[model samples]
Target: MPIAVYVLGLGIFTQGTSEFMLSGLLPDIAHDLGVSIPDAGLLISAFAIGMVVGAPLLAGATLNWPRRTALAALQSVFIAAHVVGALAPGYGVLFVTRVVSALAYAGFWGVAVAAAVVLVPAEAKAKAVAVVASGLTLATIIGVPAGTLLSQSSGWRTAFWGVAALTLVSLLCSLFAIPGGKVSTDETHTVCAELRAMARPQLWLSYAVTAFAFGAVIVTFSYLATLLTDVTDLSEGWVPALLALFGAGGLIGMAIGGKVAAAYPIRTLVLGAGTLVVASGLLALTAESTAATVVLVFVLGLAGYVTNPVLQSRVFALAPGAPTLVGATNTSAFNVGNALAPALGGMVISAGFGYASVAWVGAALGAVAVPGALWAGHLQYRGPRTGGVVAQGAASQEDPAAARARA
Candidate 1:
């Protein structure tokens, strides 16, 4: 609950707006750059690729720098990337810019969550992370819709320019607000040490849970507008409003999830994923009714994000020694889900299944995480005996209070 936590959230909002707003601008970008809509859609994939590559790599590469310094530097690069994107002349240039921006964005996210964790008490770590992540929910609520409106009225380039300006503001806020100093020597480690921390089976299971659980959310969200128009009989003008409703549900879910994740991480994961499975199944069955579609979309968003804090906190807890790298890897896992789920959803839609089929895909992905979460919980209860010798050593070195908090 520190002021710095809110500032970090503000910074995340700027970066997230840049990331999510592009989905709304794809049509305008495709027409303006003389490309097909599918081609323009590749920009999303390019960003995800950059995130998966950049998160762990950049976090390890910058392991020696102060967290505050790393965050400021990454935000500067992000702002510059958006400026370039705003001025891009063709599809190739825009695509390259999106990748570059995403690299900086991913690096920022990797460091930012670790930084947030350090700023709060062990008991408040999940809540702090939730505060930072709420920025993304807010982006879906306010930023993406506003950007889409701007693109509709002025030009797609204008949305990019607006993001650049907002990022500059966030950059200034970070410079002034975040405390200055390197991470404690005890928390810092060599590249090999960090790599060793990642060798835990439990850690990988946590990542798997993150990937599939969140992927379920994206499967339906990636084509929500299409679903509304094609099946629910909604007008195009209502898409943004409906998306905002989903974001509202996300905000509510994150608030509730943060409150419970610290004490019941695995239970929260199972319940959250279970909620997604049920919500998605209902959505698939009732997509034709406008009332049902609206209700289910909100429920889907709520259930999908309820696990965010739990997934993030679990990863950090699993690798207590390598917070930065572990946090980055977890971010990468979420993006991996983001990248793969949409492709799967697209395939289902193209195979002659209706838009509602995406919900079934989501349900299956969510279902996969249930057992994964249970297995992780079983591992946690059993201690680190089977988690790999290096990871066990790392966990044994953690503070007793911290370990108890995690339990």
Candidate 2:
């Protein structure tokens, strides 16, 4: 809703680009640095590992810093890291640079999400998160492919340079647009206060739902190209376009979900997770049919991303005292899903199950999350009677009408 929220989205677009563009440039990077493809692939893992480690670490370290200052400083660090990465001569240097960039990106994300919600009304928190996260969907459609194209036309280093330049633009936008102040207005903000909020059972339940819900999406996505080619019998050239179609569907889903997630958190979670399960199961059964596969891919993307805003907003709602830390942990939960799903999908594919089996794995993950979502809803309705910080925080934002109806 605010220009600042859009600016945060732009910043995430750049970060997401850097996060995913490596997939397309890995071969070039391996060839240039005289490393094997598998070793170069570790660079992706390095970024993920960095994100998982950096989110909570940097969030706590900078928890007391001004939100705008933290964001701008992190972006500067990201730009510097990318510049160095672009110029690095060897695999080791590039690998280190990836870790550094991911740390900056992770910290920026935690602060940015915390800042975005404070800029809007409690009822609009999910919308604000959706606006910020839409950047990632856009990156999936435009940035990664564009980076791949630039790398193909120039060099992989050129793609890194491009990301650095784009990040500079985002940083400037953030400096000018985001409000200048501490994220928490409370004078007594402390790391211990934040840590204490993490004691809530509902908060941990929400994290599990976050991981399982998103892992369901990523597992199938990680194997989509192979399924498209090997099972659906599509040409290699169609992969990017099909992936873009998936992104297009995600953008649509986010728009729809953002409008209602705050008022209908449980319904949003149930429908989104249920749709993902159904879509993945259908894809698994119909992978041989090209038309069916294409349709299901779009459905999968739509279902997968519709849960994004709910997953994020519910965390902030449940842990109002620790938004920065909660956001950082949620980010870690997301990356955990991202890393684990691909490994699980890879295992399935290697164990003599076909590429389509990844969809079944995805369905199972989604199935696990459905009950978690129901449990979250139950906690929301019943837990407020205990009257702790978690209950107070969650109650502050939950839609009373919807809560009553569910009860």
Estimate, for each residue in 1-407, the C-alpha lDDT of model 2 and write its tens digit. Answer: 89999999999999899987765676578788998544665676678778888898888888878888999999999999999999998999998999999899999888888889789987677778888989998987888778767776798999999999999999999899999988776755578999997777788888899899988987777667557877999875676677777778888888777776766777788899999999999999999999998999899889988888778777876777787789999998887777677667767766788889989999999999999988777767653454222222544455644474542
Clashes of 2: 0
- Collision pairs in model 2: none
Number of residue pairs clashing in candidate 1, backbone atoms closer than 3 angstroms, sequence gap of 3 or more or interchain: 0
Residues 248-312 of candidate 1 have per-residue lDDT tens digits of 88888888887777666777889999999999999999998989988988898788888887787
- lDDT at residue 304 of model 2 (Cα atoms): 88
**Sequence-dependent TM-score of model 1:** 0.90
lDDT against the true structure, each candidate: 0.80, 0.82
